[model samples]
Target chain A: MVDVNMTLEMVQASQVGMKAIGAGIAVGLTGIGAGVAEMAIGSAAVGATAENKDVFGLVLLLTVIPETIVIFGLVVGLLLLF
Target chain B: MLKPEQMSRLLIVASKDQMAPVVTELYRHNLFHIEDYVEAGAEGYEGFKIGSPLPGATEASGDLVKIRAIENAFSIRSEDFEVKQRRKQSGLQVLIEHELPAIEQEVEGLTVNRSKLETKLKEYEQKIAELTPFTGIPGDLDLYRGYSRLVVFAGYVEKEVSLSVPHEMFFSKGKGRHFTVVIAAVEQRSVVEGALQEAGYQAVPIPDESGVPQERISFYSSQITLIKKEIEDINQKLDAIKEKHADFLVACEEILKVQVDQTEAPLRFATTNETFVAEGWVPTNRVDAVSDSLTNVTGGKIFITVLPIDLEHDVVPVEYDNPSFAKPTQMLMDVYSRPKYAELDPTLILSIMFPLFFGLILGDVGYGLLLLGMCLVLRKYLKVDDGAQLLTVLRNASFSSILFGLLYSEFLGFELPWKPIMFSRHLKIGGGEAGGQGPAIPELMMLAIWIGILHITLGRILGMINHARQDHGDHRIKAVMANFGWLAVMWGLLIVIWTIAALPLMPDLTSLPKIFINLNAAAIVGAVLLVTGVILIARDSALEIVELPTIISHVLSYARIVAVGLSSVAIAMVVNFIAIGMLISPQLEHITVVGVLFIIMGVVVFLIGHALNMALGILGGGLHSIRLHYVEFFTKFYKGGGKKYSPFGYKRRFTED
Candidate 1:
């Protein structure tokens, strides 16, 4: 009976460990995806800003548009954690 | 507050003789945005051609150019000086005619003297550098030049040379090189040149002076110093002249500029042999005032016509009609695009929403106060045109941040004495404290989502209004219905989520009154609305069906407000723990040399870490807040490509009529 109880406890611990790994993957991969997307946009935004400074605010908004993907991932990660 | 100032098309017709007075009166009013007449394409006015500038235009422009040159010579910018009072135009004109030539001659003489002295100083310095290397040789400076039968080669060499034929050589090491002077007969010049080439010789031009090399260097150095003194004196005289005439010269410039503008006004007009026509835009409210002024100026002989506004063909210029407080927000709108004359102006709404979002993202009392102080200091000192306006926007944002900081009970990520009135953003994941309250993360996220719902709904409503006001026939109705469809779909989804998910901080919709008999009326209603919304959207355009997921994603996008804030708090907490708890507090338990050293290091780390976190907080907070509005809110309804209204008159700073 003690052995069975120990196995059950191990299972619960592994479940929590798995949840942690899942949450990490969710946020980490999405962060990488967002970074990749932002690379092209950031360069283009900078080029546009160099030519006309009035577009600075608009370009800044454009450069960070991909970051919304990371926010979604973060929300999902929080859901899994809590 | 939601629209630009109303503009009316103005047509002013006057005889050629009254043109001067009409132009002067229009400039004094400062209310006209002139549209230059195009001679080529104007219909029903083939006789009308672009008018020539008035008689005195050339002379006024010439004077204006001279004044600008004078200002440039003194490096004088009007912004650098405070005009204590406006100078009278008549006094300025007299100064220009009587005193300007004398002042110009005095200034010109000093400038010429200074430049000549500078050039002389440069020549003396060059002579000194040239003669210093020759000082290594024991010889007079004149001995190296004006030889009758001998040729001399004096320069730096890699190795000393031994001449084959008759030659006198002097060699010394100086200035990081081997200096050599070889004097040989004219007949052996080729042999000496060959020897010098083998020794890796490079020539230095000999100076034509009569003294010993060291004496000559000293003589040039003295001359350089004397010339420098003369230049300094000339500069002082020029500075005095600048101080005495700065206000007068600036006023002269202003009067000359106005004179030139008045003379050139006819260039933008359409004219025939006897009369001229000026077409321009005037603010609708100022029409009567401007007409009366023109009538009075021309002795009631001027012909004025108010043309009907043509929304279909005319590209009306936009001038923001916001209050003084909302003026700075116009800078933000300008960064995106000015609103078209027919479109709704979003500056007032942005002024309110921008600061609120900024405060939401960077809610910390210490950071907020620091930002506020920085804005105040910079706005006082930095005099750039846009910087002061930007600082005002930031100042408003900082105030909002302080308010939110109180709500969050946060001062630089540390908990305040009072319990958080809203909710705690302090995470309880570490430090081994049991029953430590985890951050109200779910509640914060819920709040962000609710904000997203309301903001997006407002945008759709505005979109509906915008389309409804446009004259797109059936397309306008479709656009309005499409906005309604999106709203319906969003609310339906919200209802469905409320019924399906037991989310924190959400109202329990099941407890509300039911319309159906025990069949989940909320679910049925939600499904019906969703389907109806989808069908309506499809009717507008099939392409819009592909964008259906955007509705969900846009709502989820607001989660960043919480996410970005939490990350900032996490960084602050980590910095505090590492600097104070791990480094300083641990070392402070015992007093020793090593302990003191560690404590000092901890203090450095704390300062640097917090400084970095504060910078990141501001940049991230400001960018993200503005991003939300520009990306999510603006894309919904804003289509901003409008011409800016610029009146054809200068705002005088130095001179008055």
Candidate 2:
């Protein structure tokens, strides 16, 4: 019974470790995806802002639109961890 | 308050004699948004042409030009100066007719004199530099010139040269070289050139001068000083004139600007040889007052008519008519686009929701108070119209943040004396396992999701109303149904999740009566609603069925509220830990010199760390909150390419008619 309990504990610990790794990958890869999506948008927003200052708020909104991808990833990661 | 002010299309036809009175009456009302008459020759108006300026326009324009020049010289901007009392129109007319020309003449003379003196000073300075290299050599400048038979090379040489031909050489030390003057026979040009090349000689042009180099430099220096003094005197005179006449000149400019505008008003009108026609938009409520005043001024001889609006063709200018409290949010609306005349204005919604989202993300009392103080100071000192409005928006956000801070029981990432009335944002997974105190990660995430669901649903409702109200004809019903379909999908998904996940604050589906063998009432209802929503959406546009997953992503996107807040709390906690725990607290056990030094270091780290975190919180909180509104909420209903209403009259600042 002692050996069986040890084996059960080992399996549980490895499962926790694997879940942690999965959570990290979910958040990390999505963060990269968001950054790549924002790269083109951020530059275009800045360029438009330079020509006309009145578009500042609109450009800012456009610049952060892709960041929602990362937010979704965060929700997924939290779901996995907890 | 939700809709823009209604506009009426106004048309006025008047004989040539009544044109002046019509223009004056329109300016007095200051409510006319004129549409410039284009030369398209549409329908029966082939003979109509754009009118030339009135009789006095040329003189008024010329006077305006002179006043602007003087204002430029004094560096005076109308907005920069405050008038204690408005100047009377009669007094300004006297200043413009008699005193303006004299002032203009005096200012022009002084500027011209100053520029000439400046040019002379530059010439003298250049001459002084040319004479500087010659000063090292001790001969009179006359010796280097006026020698027909002698060839003089007056410049620097690398080394001493023993000329093969008979020659006379004078050498003196200069900057990094020997300043040498060699007078050799002109007939021995080849031999002298070869000898000078061997010595690495560089040639300098002899000046056409007949005096000592030292005396000439002194002469040019004194002349430069004289010219500089004369220039200074001219500038002082100009400054004195500016100080005395600044008020009069600014008032004159304002009067002339109004005159020019009035005189040039006809340029935008369409006219024939005997009569003129002007068309524009005015607020519906003010149409009666404008018509009565114009008729009263023109003795009822002019023809005034309200043209019928064509929804398909007529271009109406949009003007926002909001309450005083919501006026500042118009700037934010303008940053995106103004609402069309027929569409609902979202400024009121933005005014409330924007601050709430900002507060949710940055719920810290200390940061809130700091931002509040900054906004107040800026609003007080900044006189710019747009800047003041922006500061008011920020001030509102700051107040919201303070309210949320009270709820969260947070002061700069630290817990307050009392327990948080709401869930603590600093908690992560297994937070309840440690102390069973505040809410854990799942609860906070669920709260953000709920907010998203409600917010998105509100957006869909607004979208339905917008589609119905707009002139969509037969397709209006379908458009509204599409919006309803989106709403149904969102709520259906939420209901399904509530039954499956058993999350907090969600209804217990098990407690309700079961409708089927294995399913409860809520589950069967949710599945039916989901299927119905899908069918409704497909009925509108078959392709839009592919965008169904987008609703889920949109709802999940609100999870950023918790994620961002937690990241900020984490940073503040790390900063405090590193500054106090690692640096200061360990050394506090002993009051040695090293301990005192470490304490000071820790204090520096603490201040810098909090400052950085505060800036990041403001930027992140403000941008993300506005993004939720503009990107997610507005995309549902807002279709904004409205023409901005610009009236024809000026708000007189310096002179009043």
Candidate 3:
């Protein structure tokens, strides 16, 4: 019975470890995802700027929407670390 | 190839005498105007207007004299003298004719001003180009340094004194063996060579061969840049002036609109009532709202009517009213509607089946969840119209995917640690047990077949209802007989087949004479009733001989459900095989990095490929499902030959006609 309890605890620990690893992976990939997302928006914003300078605010707002996903992932990772 | 058949009920009220008042009223309504008039007959009894107001005109009438007043109180004049009479009494002809030349002259003057403005814009662009050195440096740099042995870097020059000193000095250290200098820049070369020889004693003279000119090529690039800035400032001033001119352009357009309205009003009154009556076509569903608006506008003076537009008949009858719904009810209705006749709606069976199939093909809870989330996000925020509509459809699909995901017991291509919902508990089973222990193939197959049967039965029921509503006595009878009687027969056949197959294994049940007697009696009764129903249905139709073939084909259409379900399962199997094979490879085991990469790639490929396949399959299957309803089911009972409604109003396409 003691052995069973030890094995169960070990499995639980391993599960937590696996979850931690997944969290790290999610955070590490998020930067690359954000960069890719911003590349298209940045180029589009530059093009729009050439036509009308007033579009800068709007372009900036739209470009930042995708970055929030990465930030959320980071927050989750940080919470897990603590 | 159907020609539009003209309605025989129309009547024209515009005689030569009536044309004057009609034209005046039309102009008063600001519906149309006449621009230019030409006499057609010797008596000037017939004439054509060159320019008329386009359709969709809406404005208050101008202060032109009434044509009706002139006709009512005018002296007798020769046909040729009609213009003089019109000018003398009505004065409207004079006002209309006078306004034309003045507006034209104003427009011509504005055109000239616009050209001048355009030229000023071009001049400003040239000035801006000249002001910036960043734009001019690259082109000029090549011209100044081409083939010159003397190198200049940040105002420092390196000049060659002798040809015999080997061309290595021109290039940076270590790269000299690859580079050979063909030209040298030198001033008083013999003196420089003597000094060099005194220092090293190996210097020799060769002809001065540098391509660079002796005098510096000076140009006022900076001055040009300043001038360009000044021009840009001038352009800003010009832009302000042009904005003011735009108001004048708007005013001129308004004047032109008035003039065109005056010209065409007479023609519109004379022609539209006779040629094409006042009519507007709107979406069938929006008819009530449009009619209410029309009634409110005219204070119930104008008549509002409806007609269902039949594509097959090419006829729009005068009395068919459509039901109001924001979305089309049937999957087929979306495609068959007036605006989207070319696109086929995939909402029918495909709507439900596609997501189910996709869930089966994908069989991964994690991927399904991802797809659902993505679809939801796109639907909520994206400005794309079709994509948003598709997301709404995918919402329904996601539910089916979730259901399938649970059944497959997969989460991101891995079996979940927790027990699956379908099985009560985990069985100690392998693939060899009953061929594959996950799900019984016979059970799944039976489910697919049953689904097909139910779908076909529903379609037949709908057909019978539609036919009954039409009140076509014989046709209604036929629809009922074929739909219900055949279903009964099919059920009886299934029972007999099942009993016969099971009898050998159950001797006690088989030996009972009562079971056989009941089965034979039921089968005979069902067969007789079905044959009678078919004969009854065929009694009134000309192609009664072909009724059996038609009925059989209709029944066979339901088989698609089973076929589509099986294909979904097959696709899932293939995806699983590829993912599992890649994961378990011996070489891949040692190469952890490659193995991880392969797993990720496999998961990604599986997710995308299966999802796309599911989406497309759903669309195709949905369309086929709707087709089954429209052709097989609806044909059994419905006769949709109703006409659409149209009312008199400003057309949508032209703002001012």
Candidate 4:
């Protein structure tokens, strides 16, 4: 009793929903990924600090580059929302 | 290929007493000056030295002279041979007499030339400063900031004028018109008044304290050309002088080298203790010769002993100790020195596995090939020390990726018109093929599992051999039983299971019945053998209960390979689905902006998603690889952490020279 022509529309709609969820998950997980990445950079920063106190800016810049992943995910989520 | 193993014992001695005599002897041979001193109330005296040789002191004549001094001063006389510390004083005297005047003359000449060049440069700069106002307005005005005061000179007429403003400021009212303002600064009043009079403005010059406003960077224009000319002249003079005196400088350097050598050599010999007592590190292979040399020098009075030290895990609490950071640093050190011991020699296993997993998670043949090509080109042109080794491993993995690409039937996640050389037998690619027309997915999975099994088996075998070698008889029994006995039991069980499965599926096949019967008998025999092996192994251990769990855990750790491989494939599939779905969507208008956007989005998603997947895969795969080596493989044969041999030498940063 299923309408064959309407199946394609149903599938597309489901895809849109799935994509929205995927975007959210991607954004949420990106924060976790950023934290994971910062663990290594933070350790390296501590190591650098042993040698020089003036490297805080450089370390902060490097550590933030990875955080761009979360920003990218956020941008995608915003697009989905709109 | 045979794996390289570390030597059992390190030849380097760490004791301070043991190190002193060797250092003293090397110093004596190299003609290094040593100083000995005693604190007023201390029971023991201390000696120190500038031990390393100066540059260009390794010539035959210099070495011969130092050797002769050592033989005459220290070898012949067992009595205390205190260095005649007055040699430095005598050397200084000689320097003043023979070389000081020439050096002073050269320095004076250089100073005179520099002064003359500086004066000429200043004159040229002044001329350029005067000419700066004549040049047309230079470059864009947006680059400059701060208050700009214009003193416009209009000759013969006063008129309403409009000035062109930047296009960005077109919205502002009255910004295009030139406006007149009264000046306040006293220094600028005369200049403003003169300009206004020249321009035929209303003839009133205001005498005020505030100067006329002008452009901030106006002074720099005139000096630019003259400054350049002066710099060029000075450079030319310097070039001429450098060319003329190049050989003279070389000769002076040689003379200094000889003088330092002569002075330091005799002092080196005289300072060394007559009855030498010293200890220091030597390469493991050179330990015998070092010990023999010590015996010859001190007539067997020196005691020499070598101890094994682990370089990998042993943390020396020196000035740079930070426990949190040390773990990764030690891992890096292990990677740097004797890298093969971590996995395979050259870490080929890690190298191959990482990129393969990366490419798998990436799942785009085009990108994979691009990366492969880039890595290859870098490996070829760059002068990296590890380039060749890393390239060989990557080249192999790239080939593996190409193979996997064929199997996945993906080229940048696009289906090909031609038949794929390899294809997944489980999931029909593009839903075209139904039955088995390609390589079986289960077969590939089985191959991966088999490889994992082989690797773990190798680890166990190594562990057994190392135990046997380290402890002769009964102590090795457990290792042997844990490896071989378990393998035998597992194989026996598998044979029986295979037979049972085959009996119903292939009743007509005579081979199945024979295999089934034989395997069933083998399983019973294998069980008895396993029990006997375990009992023998358990005999030496105090607590059988503890050893059982350890053995079981080690065996089970082999499952990580399958887990990692499955994760790689799953991630790849997801990326492929997203990429293909974007490209093939019918809603996007073909050949239009929407269509182009879809294509671009697809490409971006493919690249970004796969790249992330690759990075994650590498982390997981690399850690798992290292774990397999450290816990499973090295637990068998390796007792790392040996001290590396470091000789007294110059530290080269850029090049060997």
Candidate 5:
């Protein structure tokens, strides 16, 4: 009876570990999403700035707009962990 | 000193003959910005024709072209090539007239001869390749040509064709080679060529030579070797010429370019049959010096008159006169827009704000150290031409990050041993008695908003100062009224927002009566200031009232600083949690094999996670900082579209003068 209870307790603890794993997947995927967004915008920003530096302010703002997505991901992930 | 340099409009009238001398004097002074002279015939102000370039201008440009060619040939640069001196004008003239042309002619002759040799050598190689297969055949005494009826194809034939051809017509069967020589009739030529092609045959017509194929091969081979040697010898001579004339070419180009520029300056002025009128802007302090020099040089025949301020006509060029620390920021300003000549130079403020914003967003000591180390490495080793100032800005940002890092007690998202002097919501900062609360999103937001208020206020103040400093004449009151009204409105708006945002953060001080009183006061002040600003602004443009939201948005934009910092720290914290969990898990301690594997996995996670965080930190921190300054801060006071003051002068590289 004691052995069955110990095994049941291990199963419960392993299930609890799934929360951390879920948080990891969420943040990791969103980070990738942000990276992909930046990849497109960053190239365009570089190209625009190369041609006429006046558009730098606009380009910088556009390029970092995707950063907000990552920040949102981070908050959601941190909330899950703590 | 805070404003752009003062400029005075100058109109100089000089004789056509004296234009070159006068231009030389102006360039020597290097304080004049020549305005392009436009024809005013439509408005009925045309007697002065646009000045033509002087006679010497053509010659000087001609010399410059030749010098450039020589420089290209030798691959000479002023920086790399050590010039003996700023070759005197007469020395350059002599070289241009004598030595340069001689060396050019000599090099041209050698190159021409070498090319001829190369072509002959290539022809010989072609003959050798053709004659190589026929070396087995003995005779070559013009035997392969001038035979239309015989259809003599003295070339390689298929081995199968060898049997067929010898039977049909005379042919040579090569020993142990795939192709053989063949001779066939005109009627059989098409059929024979078809068979040859099927057997993968190729044609090699015998050359018109008077020797056996072997002897001819040897002769061509020897000639090719001799030609190659001669070409090598010519190359050595060319190398000698390059070494001798490279520095001289660079120096000559600089001196001649200056001459060409001076001689061409007349084209910007307006000239008639006898006299020319040169109109341009010169800084006020240097105007007297320019006037004195032109007078001294032209024997006082020229009259330099300082025209009164022409508001309706003149577009004053802007020259920023900032100290060295702020000079790099000037590049950033110029990259965006040059401030109007009448406005304040924002270089000093940008130099401070840009790095601080960068640091605030990237508040971690480890990353700062990495950045500093990378910068030191780059500066120490790389010889970059354009990115030097970028490195300096990065270094300044790195330093600020380090300072903030210490205050926040963060070193790669790990809390430092010492207590944090400044609180950061994203950091534990310290433990037990030494620590306070970690990051709270609301408080961070409030702090960001407050910083935004301070930064934008400074911009408004500077802008107001700029307006007040302008020679508004009778419009000064209106300028002050509008500018001050806007300033008051911004301050009032900040107070109203702060009172609400900081209420929860200041929970201890929150009371019903105090909240009501503060809210009432802030609302009244904000409403009054907004009404006053709208009234003053309505005098200029009622459209500006539509931009009320822009002010609020600019302040809200500062939240990105805290948001980006929080993300950087949170990602790092997550990385550490996973990594440390792997190493010190209670479940895995007894299982040594699993523990070892976990440690490996943990280290990889740590590296990859931190690397990702680092990249994002740089991109977000650097760009958001720049965006804040350019959009939020610069819009407060700065309006770009100033003409860059470029005086007609040379920052000489190879020459002293």
Candidate 6:
């Protein structure tokens, strides 16, 4: 097996930063995607919940389901760096 | 039980002699939800018209309408003043006999007087403006009005135009603010008008009055003062009437309403001169008690029959009977839908599962306490009635969150000092605290997938039970197979994923050949079950293929359960990092002016940052869990188009039976 110090020296600091950068982009873009999906769903959800209080829980659920996109991105991001 | 309470139709027949006693007894029992029987298609009975209202209903309705009008005229608000404790029959009789007629007359007089005063006040105000401009005129307005030949243009003009107009025209200085002037008939009247137009002349329309401008000014000024006093007097009278009758007017309207409803009760039945018949629905479990009570009340003279027959096509009212602890979960189902009479009620399952997911996302003790405290404050101190359902959901969610908080050993993104009831969140996976390590991201993803597996399986199980409940003959094999197939395919997918993710664990899997073979076997198992479930659900069409991608996405959706919690913790940790940075800032090395400024800024940042994090935590944690139920969980088993139960009985306020 190669020495741990030698292996660490072989990897460039900039290349390590690049992985971190990729993870950030993955998370950031997913955030924008989640926000867009929430905007469209949220408007209808709010209107329905206003008409009847009963629809509030369902509306809240529908409004946040798109959040999974960001979580997927977070997983991808975490995998990249860690 | 995960189903609405069972119900059956009821019919009661009472002779004219027993109708009063029967109606009274039914009112006391509060059992029937009356179905108004209109003889729309009774072929033999064209003479059987809908039942008419009992005696005095007309009078009661008239009194009610009058009370309403008085209340409106007086602008009476029920909550404006304290009302009498309860509205008794005697109280209503006294109000109708003594107070209503007097209140009606007084309100009428006050309204007429107020309107007259209002009109006079407007007239006086208009005259005051008109006469003020004319007061400076040398001659009376009447003197100007009598002119037959004079080209009288009397109005204000701009400063520039007043100078340029013909000198022979009446040049007396009027109100200088606008340079008011009267252009009498000049020799060149046309040319003069052209000059006036160029000068921006605004002609004042003269009112037909008998007196001079100065006299009229004084006359209007005095008139306005008198009218102001009169209007004030009218206002005072109306206010006094309101003060005296505000409470009484509110009570009077309520009494008349109850009287009207009681008198109009017979209109729901089919009545002949000799007999009355009415139909309604009652909960099956309470039918024996209701029947017994009605018989005893009417001395068994009137027949009360419980019809046990079931009509599958008829729309039946649905009544939910959830235990008190599970009532909040019913609020979630109510917003989505009311279950059909024959389908399952998902509230109890929802109660257990919804908060579990919520608490999983929260996973922080400090924020849980904050949320719980906020809900308690809102529910107890605020006493707001609207959105009580939402508040109940928040309270339940926070309770679960506190439970999870202890398990995760997190206190506002900080690790607890003592032993946790379970593992810490920091040990789970991914970034959370400022300086903490965790298991691989893949591990968390797997946990999310497992949760999805269980949630979806439970949904299918419930769906299977719902179908079985509605089935009459031997269990409908196709429906059962479809539900059973869903369960099989989900498990198949779960095992396949678990097997692949754990492939490296097979003791130095330098043997790539064995890994490939294991994956192949798992894939085959998943594929065969998937196809079987598809065939069961969609035997006639290729449309079933569309659900495969949906199934995959639905499982992935559970990833949010982990994702939202991670973000919430990240935000909290970030806030703490910033706050601590300020407290121990490098700028604080010499205690300079800038250092003190930075400390203050940091304190503000810390408070605002944590406050924002806590708010988002509640929304993200509470809502995402609820989403798992409605979107991922409920579609599996629930069919919701049940008619809501609204009994034909008044909810009395300020009255009791």
List interface RMSDs for the candidates, in order.
2.1, 2.3, 22.7, 15.7, 4.6, 3.2
lDDT of 1: 0.86
Measured by lDDT, the strongest candidate is 1
lDDT of 2 by residue, A20-58 (tens): 999899899999999999999999999999998667667
lDDT of 1 at B192: 93
RMSD of 1: 3.9
Once superposed on the true structure, which residue ranges of model 5 sit more than 4 Å away at CA? A1-82, B40-45, B79-87, B111-236, B363-386, B409-417, B424-446, B460-510, B514-553, B563-621
Structure candidate 1, residue pairs in collision: none
Candidate 2 Cα misplacement greater than 4 A, ranges: A1-32, A48-62, A80-82, B132-143, B150-229, B427-439, B505-528, B542-546, B575-603
Candidate that scores best on TM-score = 1
State the fraction of real interface contacts model 6 keeps. 0.40
Comparing 4 with 5 on DockQ, the higher-scoring candidate is: 5
Per-candidate TM vs. native?
Answer: 0.89, 0.87, 0.43, 0.44, 0.72, 0.81
Model 6: chain A TM-score against the true structure: 0.84
Clash pairs for candidate 2: none
Higher-ranked by DockQ: 3 or 5:
5
Judged by DockQ cut-offs, the docking class of candidate 6 is: acceptable
lDDT of 5 at B231: 91
lDDT tens per residue, model 2, B480-573: 9888988887787777766666787666565666668767778787888888888888888989999898798788888888888777766776
Residues B115-170, candidate 4, lDDT per residue (tens digit)? 77677667555544433332222323232223355332211224342323211111
**Which candidate gets the maximum DockQ versus the true structure?**
2
DockQ of 1: 0.50
Worst 10 residues of 6 chain B by lDDT: B503-512
Measured over all alpha carbons after superposition, the RMSD of each candidate to the real structure, in angstroms, is: 3.9, 4.3, 19.6, 15.5, 7.4, 5.6
Q: Would you give the TM-score of chain B in model 2?
A: 0.88
* TM-score head-to-head 3 vs 4, winner: 4
How accurately is candidate 6 docked according to DockQ?
0.33
Q: Which residue ranges in model 4 land beyond 4 Å of their true spot?
A: A1-82, B1-272, B275-368, B377-396, B403-441, B472-483, B489-519, B542-563, B584-590, B620-627, B636-639, B650-657
Chain A superposition TM-score per model: 0.90, 0.89, 0.69, 0.68, 0.81, 0.84
- State the TM-score of the second chain for every model: 0.90, 0.88, 0.47, 0.47, 0.74, 0.82
